[model samples]
Target: MKKSRLILSLLLAFASTLASAQSENPPPVKEDFKPSVLNQPGKEYPQVNSQGYVRFRIEAPDAQKVHVSLGLGGRGGTALTKGADGIWEGTTEGPLDEGFHYYHLNVDGGTFNDPGTLNFYGSVRWESGIEIPAADQDIYALKDVPHGKVEQILFPSKSTQTSRRAFVYTPPGYGKDRSKKYPVLYLQHGWGEDETAWSNQGHANLIMDNLIAAGKTQPFLIVMTYGMTNEVKFGQLSSFDITPFQTVLLDELIPYVDANYLTQADPAHRAMAGLSMGGMETRTITLANPGVFSYVGLLSGGSISMEDLEKSPDFKKNVKLLFVSYGSRELDNPRRGPWGDPKENTAAVTAAGLKTHFYVSPNTAHEFQSWRRSLYVMAPMLFK
Candidate 1:
C-alpha cells in the first residue's frame, strides 16, 4: 500500500508539471509562420506588364464587390471571377504609359491590397506602381545619341561645412586638342535642386550640344553647382554658412579647371547665373565678389528688393551685363508675386546706374519652361 501511494503521488506531480509547461509555452502555430499578406489579405492591387495595361488578383474572403482605380482619368468597376481557390482575378486592357500610377482595391464592405503583386504604394500615404519601357518611356534615354561625360566633383565650399560636388559638363571637343581654350559658364539650379538638376531635368546638355554642333555657340565648360546653404531651407539666414562653398569655388574648382583645361581665368570670360534661390545666390556672389564674373543672369528670382542692390558697393562698378528674366504669369497673383517682384527690382537696379536687360516670357510661372527659355536667351550674352 505504501509503494502504491508513492507511485500515485509521483504521477500527480508529473501531470501538474506537464500542465504548467503547456500553459506557459504552446506549440508552434502555422498562422504565425504565414507571411504578412496571407494573414490579412483584403485589397487587390493591379499589376503592370510590358505592354502597360494593369491587371491583378485580389483575395477577400468576406468581400461582396471588387473594383480597381486607374490613372488620371481611369475609372471602372469590373466583376472579378471567384476561382475555386477562393481568389478573384481580372485583367484590364493593354499598353499603359510607363510612369507612376496609383490604384486601390475596393471590396464589398472594405478595400484591401493585391496579394498577387509585390509592387504597391500608399493611399493617403499610399504606395505607387511603377512601369518601365511602357507607354511613357524617357525620350532621351531611349535615343541613340552620344551623351557627354558628366562628373560629380566634391570640393570645399566657403558656404558649407563638408562642401558639395558640382556637375561639370565638358563638350565633345574637351580634351582632343591641347591648345584650345573654352569659356566657362557658372549655371545654377533652383531651390531643393543640386548641380545635376540642369543636366538631368533641364536638358542643358542637349541644348549645349546642339548649339555647339551647329556652331551657334562656342564650345565651353558648364559648371553647375549648389547655390543655397542648409540655412536657407529653414528661413533663417543667420545660421547659413556659405564661406566654405565660396572658398571651394574660388580656390578649388576654379584652379582645378584652369589647370586641367584651357580656360581664361579673367572675369571677363566667366558668367554667373541661376534660377530662384540660385538667382539670389548669383546676385549675392556677383555683388560681393566683384570682378569675378562679368555677366549675371537671374530667372524668376524671389524677394529681391532695391535695398539689396543699394547696399552692395560692387553692384554698379563690377557687373557688366545683368540679365533679369521672369515669367509674365508669375508677376501677378500668388505663387511668387506677393512678396517682392524680380521685374520691379531689376528696374530699380537699372535706375541705380547698372546695365540691366529685362525680358518676360508669356504663360509661365517659375517653372522649367521658364528656365529653359532663360538659358536659351542668356547663353548668347555669355562670354560675348
Candidate 2:
C-alpha cells in the first residue's frame, strides 16, 4: 500500500507539470483556418491559415507513406503523419507563395492527385492545385461591373496538319457593338501549360474585364494559343524549333482571328506577349518577323539587344511599344543575355529613341503571379 501510494503521487505530479507547460505555451498554429478556395465542390481537406501555411488531411489508410509536393524553399515538400484514425495530416514548414500553385501527392512511391482539390493543366499534365489568396486577388475576382466571354475557336493550321484551338477574349461590350473593331493582343503561356492556361489559371479574361470596366485600359481582344508546335518534352528545349509555332501564329492563327473577329487587322494594332518559355518564343518570333507585331512584351522571358535591332532594322521604326518584365526574385542571380543585363538592355534600347518599358514584380518568382502582374501593367501601354 505504501508503494502504490508513492507511484500514484508521482503520476499525478507529472500530469500536473505537463498541463502547466501546455497552458503556458499554446501551439503556434492559428485557429482561423478555412478550406482552400480551390477545393472541389463539397470536399474539404486542404486548409490554409492566416499565415499562408497549408494544412493537408489525406485518406490513405494502407499506404506506407504520403507526402505533399508543396512546401517552402527547398524542403522537398511536406511529410504527413498518420494518426490512429488512419488519416495522414501535416502542415507545411513555412508559408507558400500567394496565388495558384500546382501540386501532387506521393503515395507509396506513386504520384496521385489530392482528391479534395481541383486539377489544373501544368507541368505538362493535369495536376492538383491550390490557391493561396493574394492581397490583390480582387483584380482577378469576378465583379458585377462587366464580364467578357472566352470563345474557343478551331482554326485550320496547314503547317501542323491539324486544326489548332485558341481562346479569344472579347471585352464586355464587344458583342453589343457589332461595328466596333478593337486591337488584338496575342498572349502565350509557359512551357508546360497550354492555351487554356491564360483563361483557366491566369484569369486573362477577368484581368481584361476589370481593367476595361475600371477604364484603366482600352477594351481589346486577347488571344491565347498553344506554343508547343513540335511536342518537345522536358530537357529537349535546346532542340526545340520555333519555326513551326511561328508559322502557326503568323500564317494560320492570326489570319483566322482577323477573319473571324472584329479586329483592326494591322501590325500597328497587334501586340504579342508570353511568359517563361513562351517569352523565348516571343523573342524569337518577334525578332524574326519584325513587321508582324507593333508591340512586343515578354514576361520572365529573354531580352532584346542592339544586335537584334541591327538584325531587324525595321523593329525600331515599326514597333510602337516594347515591354519587358520579370519577377524581382528571378533577378537574384541574373542570367546574363548575349548582350548584358536585361534591365541594362532595356535602358540602352530606350536611350536609342525606341519606346521601351521594363517592369519587375515585387515579391514573386517565376510563377503565374508574376505573369499576371505583367499583363496588368502591359495592357494599358498597348496600342497607344
Candidate 3:
C-alpha cells in the first residue's frame, strides 16, 4: 500500500469502529442518575447512572431546538425536547464505554459548549468533555499518594523555526533526589491534538502516580508533544510528512530534555510511543533512528509487520521491547472496514524473534480509554 493510503486506511478503520449499538433488548435504565464528575460545580443536568447511560438537561427557552452531538454508537446523537418549563432534555440510546468523550451542543443550529461541563481540547477545538466511570477507574484515580508533576517546557526547534512546547512528567521525588537519573519516554498525541492531550484527556500523570504508589512500574519521565498530524486534512492524511515533527523530536527535544533534566541519555534507556497517527510516526522514526529509542509502543495505532523487519533489520538487534494495543470495539466491531488485523501483524513480528507484547482493552473503541490501558500495561515492561 502507498504510505499515505496505508495511514488513511487506519484512520478510516478508527472512524468505522465508532458506530456501535447495545443489545437488542437492554435492561431498564434505573433512575439513579447523578452529576458527571466532569460537570461544573452545582450542575446536575448532565448525568450518568450505574448502567453507563447519560442524561442531558439544558435550559434554552428561546431556542427553537437543542441537540447533543454525542450518542451511542456515534449515530444521530441525542435529540432534546423542550419541556413546558423551557428546559431541553434528552438521553443516550445506550450506555457509553468508560472514559472521556468530547461532544458539543447544537442549539438552534449554532455550535456551542455545554454550560454545565468543563471543556477539553479536542478535534482541534475546546469541546465539552464528559467522563463515564470505569470499572477499573482506580487505575488512574487521584489518590493520596505522592504524585508526579507534569511541567510544560519550551524547547527551541531549528527545524520548525520556533520554540515548541512539550509536557514533561517527572516522577515523584524528582526534585528531592537530584542525583537520580530516570529513563525518558517520548510520547506523541494523535490527530487534532496538541501537547496537552495526554495529560488532560489521558490523565497520564495520575496513572503514573497510582502505579508508582503501588510499586507497579519504575520511576521515569514521559515527554508529550504535538505530532503535527492535524495540518493535513483527513482527506490528505497520506500526504502527511513526518520529517518536520521528526526533526523537532530528534534533533531538538531530546537534547533539551537531556540537558535540562537528569536522564539516562542513551538509546537503551529511551523509549517512544504514540497513538493512532502518532503510532505511524513512532514506527517510522524508531526504525529509522535505530539506537535512538530502545522501547516502542503503538496504542490504537498501527503494528509492525514482517515487511517492517525485512526493511529494518536493526530493529531486531537494537530495540528492546515493542508494545502493540487496540480497543476490543475497534478490533471486533462488525461494522468496521478491512484495515487488516493488527493482531496478525503483531504476531508475525513476535514470531520473528523480536520481543513483542499485544493487548486489547475490553469494551472500548479508538478513544483515550484504550490508550490509558495500553500505557498502564506497557509502562511496566519498559526499561526492564
Candidate 4:
C-alpha cells in the first residue's frame, strides 16, 4: 500500500510540472498586424456622390478628437460625431471642383493618414494628401475611366554611369496603329521628383488620355526624365550646371526612346515641356541643340536670357513654337525660380522670330493644378 501511494504522488507531481510548462509556452498568434480600419464588414460611410460633402470615418478607440484640413486656399472643418464603437465621422462643405487639391488629417494636431483611400503626395512629401472621388465633377480627379500607360524605364545618362529612370506615356492607341509613327514630346519633371511627377502629381497621363479619346489633342508619346544631370537633386543646384543633363537627354535618353518606340524622330515631330526647373531644362535643351526639338512648352519655369537667344544662331529658323506659361498667383512668389518672369524671355524669343505663346492663369498659384492646366492647354499645340 505504501509503495503504491508513493508511486501515485510521483505521477501527480510529474503531471503538475507538465501542465505548468505547457501553460508557459502558448501557441503563436494567427492574425498578423494590419492597418487600422474604420469600416468593417457591413459598415460603411454614407453614400455621397460627386457634388456633396467630403466624408471620412475612422475607428480610433483612444482618439478624443478627429478633423481634416481642406487643401488650397481655405481652412478645414471638424468631424461631426464619435460613435460608441470608437468610430469618428466628419464632413466638409465642398467636393472641390475639377482641379487637384491636397490635404491632411489632424488627430488633435498629431497627423494621421486616411485608412480607406489611396494616398497621393505631391512633388514633395507624401504626408500631405487629399481624398479623390470625393464629390468632384472632374473626371481626372480619380474617376475609373480607361487610363493610359505610364512606364518607368531606365536609360544611360552621360552625366553619370548610374542609370536614370524616366516616365513615358503612350496614348490609348499607341500599340494598335503600329504603321503610323507618332510625334514625340520629351517632357521633364521639376527638381525633387522622378519621372512619375508629371503623371501622378501633375496628372499629365490622364490629361493626354482624355484629350486623345476626345480628339481634342494630337496623340503623342511623352518621355519625362529626371532633370538633374550628375546632381542628386534638380533644383538643389543651380540651372548653370544643367548642361550635362541636356547632354544626357540628347546623347542618351532621346536616342534610346526613339529607337525603342514608334516615334517620328524628326525635329518637327519632336517637342519639349516641363514645370519649374524642368521648364528651365526644356529651354536650355531647345536653345543649346537648336533644330532638335521644334516645339517647346514652358510651364511655371524656364530661366532663359536674351544672351541665350543671341548665343543660339539658329534659334529663330529651327524652332516652331515657344509656349511660356505661368500662374498669375505665382508672380509674387520667388520660390517659383526664374521662370515666373516671362516678359524679357518672351520678348527675346519673339524677337528671335519664334512663335511665342505667353499664357497666364489668373488666380492660379505655383502648384500642380496650375501645371496640369498648362499641360492641357499646351498639348493641343504639338504636332500641328
Candidate 5:
C-alpha cells in the first residue's frame, strides 16, 4: 500500500509539471483578422488573420451548399455552414502557405467567384485571389524607389499568323541613355497563365524596381509572353507540342524585340526562364537553340540533367548560368517530378564544371511566391 501510494503521488506530480509546461508555451491564439489586401474596395468578408487562416463570407441565403476551393484540402473541401442570418461563412481549418492563392465558391453545385475579393487568372480562367502576408514580404514590397515601366507590345507572329502580345520591363535608366543597350531576359509564364502574370501576379516589375534601387540586381530588360499553355489541359500534358510556340518565340519574337528595343542582340547577353510548364518550354527551346541564350532559369519547373549536357555540348560550353529552384514544400512531397531529384540533378550539373545553382524557397509550394523568390535570387547572377 505504501509503494502504490508513492507511485500515484509521482504520477500526479508529473501531470502537474506537464500542465505547467503547456501553460508556459500555450498554443497560438487566433489573431484578429483584417480585410485581405487583394479584397475589393471596402469589402470586409474575405479576411486573413496573422496565423494565415482565411475567413470567407458569402450572402447566398438560398444556396443549398457552399464551399471554398482553396486551403489545406482541395477544391470543394471547405464546406461553409449557413448561419442564422442567411450568410454562408467559413474559416480555413488551418493556416495556408504564405503568398497568393486563387479560390472560387461552389454554391448550389454552381461554380462562382467570391464577390469580396479581386480576380486573378489561373486554371485558365479568372478566379478570386487572396494574399496571405508573408514573413519575408519586404523583398517584393512596394518602396519609394525608381519604378520601371511595363510596356505592352504586340509583335506579329507569322507562324501563329496573329499579333501576339508581350510585356516588356525596361529598367529605370533605360530612356536616359538612348545608346545604351540592355541585356534581355525572355521570361515565360506557367501553364494556364498569360503575359500579364509576371506583372500582375508575380509583380516582376516591382521586384526589379526595388532590386535596382537597392543595387541588389543588374538593371536589364525582361520580356513575358503567353506560352500557349491554356490549350493543353492538365491531364493531357503529354500531348502538348513545342514546335509551334518555339517557332513563334525564336523566329518571330526575338527578331521583333531586337529590332524594336535597344537590346544587346548577342547570345552572351540573352537568357530564357519559365515557371512550371513554362520551365519545360524553356528547357526544350534552350536545348534546341544553343546560341540564342547564355543563361537559363527554371522555377518550380524542372532541372537540367547530365544526359542533357552530354547531348548539347554547345550549351554546356557557352551557358553562363543554369539556375533551378523549387518550393521547399514541393521537394518534401512524395512526387519528386519527372527528373527524379532536382537537388541531386543540380548537384551533378555543378560537378560537371558548369556554373549551376539550386535554390529551394522556404515554406512555399508551387506558386507565384516561389517563382518571385527564384527571380530575385537569379537576377543578380545574370549577364556577369
Candidate 6:
C-alpha cells in the first residue's frame, strides 16, 4: 500500500509540473487575419493578422517545395507545408515590419509571383507585394479631399539618346489658377525602380493631397524620372556613373518641365530628393550643381559631410533646405558611409548656418516605408 501511494504521488507531481509548463507557454495565435490591402481585387490568399504575422496559402498541388521570400532575418524566407487537402500553407514565424514589403515565391526552385497579390516593380523585375498595415497609413490614404494630377510626359534626353518618360504631380488648385506658379521638387526612385515608384509604391501624390487638404503644406509640383542612364548590373555599384543621369535631369528634364508646366523656374524654388541609389544621385547632382537646386533631400541614401560643402563653394549660399533621413533599422550600424555618422554630418551643415533636417522612420528598414515618410516630413519644410 505504501509503495502504491508513493508511485501515485510521484505521477501526480509530474503531471502538475507538466501542466504548469504548458500554462506558462504562450497561447496559439487567434485566427482574425484578413487579406492584405495590396492583394488583387478578388484574390484572398495572402493575409495579415493584427500582430503583423503574414499567412500565405498557395495552390501548388505537385510542387515538391514552396517558399515565400519574406520573413524574419536574412533570406531564409518562409517554408510552406503541404496539407492533406493538397494546399500549401504557412504563417510567418514572427511579425514583419509595418509597411509595404516586396516578395515572391520559390516553387521547386523556380521563381514566380504570388498570383494572389498585385505585382510591384522591384529587384529589377515585377514581384508580388504585401502591406503590413502601417499605423500612420492615413497620411497616404485617398480621401474625398481635393486631389492632384500625376501627368506623364516624354522629355527629349540628348545624353541618353532617347525620349525619357517623367511623371509630374500638379497640386489640387494648380489648374484652377493658371497665373500661379508652384515650386518644383525633382524626386527619384531607388535602384531597380523607375519614376512610377513614387506614385505607385510611395503614394507621393496622395501624401501631398492629404497634406495640402489639411493645410499642413504648401502646394508644390513634384517631378519623377528614371535615374539610371547607363546599363549597370546589380553588383556593379562602383561603375555606376552619375554624369549621364545628371545631364539628363539637369539639361533635358528641367528645361522640358519649365517650358511645359507652370513652375517657379529658379534655384530657390527647386528641390531634389531621392531614395537609396536615387539618394546617392541627389547628393552628387545637388552638390555638383549647387546653383541649380536650392533644396536637397536624401532619403535612406547617404549624408552630406562638411568636406562636401567645402568642395562646393556655393552650396552654403545656394542651398536652403538640406533634408536627410533613414530607416531606424538602417542606422543600427553607425558606419553608414565614408563620411561616418549621418547625424553628425547634418549637424555640421546646420552649424554652418544651412537649414538642415534629419528624420528616422521607426521600426522600418531601407524600404519604401522609410522613403514615403521622408517625403511626408520633407514636403511641408520645402520652399518655406
Best by lDDT: 3
Clashes of 5: 0
For model 1 the local lDDT of residue 295 reads: 85
Per candidate, the number of residue pairs that clash is 25, 0, 2, 2, 0, 0
Cα RMSD, model 2: 14.5
Please give the CA lDDT of all the candidate structures: 0.58, 0.81, 0.85, 0.63, 0.81, 0.83
TM-score of 4: 0.68
Using all chains and alpha carbons, the TM-scores for the candidates as numbered come to: 0.59, 0.90, 0.95, 0.68, 0.90, 0.91
Which ranges of candidate 2 are over 4 A from the true structure?
Answer: 1-28, 334-339
Error of 2 at 214 (Å): 0.5
Model 3 Cα lDDT, one tens digit per residue, 1-384: 277466756565675455244565556888999999999889986999998889999989999989998987646789999999999999888787788888899999999999999888776678898889999999888899998899999889877677888999999999687788999999988776778989988999999998888999999999998887336654556667787788888989999999999999999999999988788789889988887999999887778888888899999899899998888888776533223577888888888898999999988888888899999999999999
Q: lDDT for model 5, on a 0 to 1 scale?
A: 0.81
Ranking, TM-score, top scorer first: 3, 6, 5, 2, 4, 1
Name the regions of candidate 4 deviating beyond 4 angstroms.
Answer: 1-98, 103-112, 121-124, 131-148, 156-159, 228-244, 303-305, 332-340, 343-348
Q: Looking at candidate 3, what is the lDDT of residue 21?
A: 48
| Superposed Cα deviation of residue 204, candidate 4 (Å) | 2.2
Summarize candidate 2's per-residue lDDT along 99-173 as a digit string, tens digits. Answer: 777889999999999999988888778888887788988888888878889999999999989998999999987
What is residue 162's positional error in candidate 5, in angstroms?
A: 1.1
Better of 1 and 4 by lDDT: 4
What is residue 333's positional error in candidate 2, in angstroms? 3.4
lDDT of 5 by residue, 342-364 (tens): 89888998999889989998887
Candidate 1: count of backbone clashes, pairs at least 3 residues apart or interchain: 25
Winner of 1 and 4 under TM-score: 4
lDDT of 4 by residue, 1-384 (tens): 343233223322221210011122333333332221212335344223344234567777688777766421333344546888888876544433333444456786687665554455443445333323312225244445566788889886655777888888987767777787989988877655556677876778888878776778878899988665655532333223655777788889889998889999899999988876677667766877898988888887654556766788786677788888876655544434433346667877687577888777654555565677788788888788
In candidate 6, the residue pairs with backbone N, CA or C atoms under 3 Å apart (3 or more residues apart, or in different chains) clash, namely none
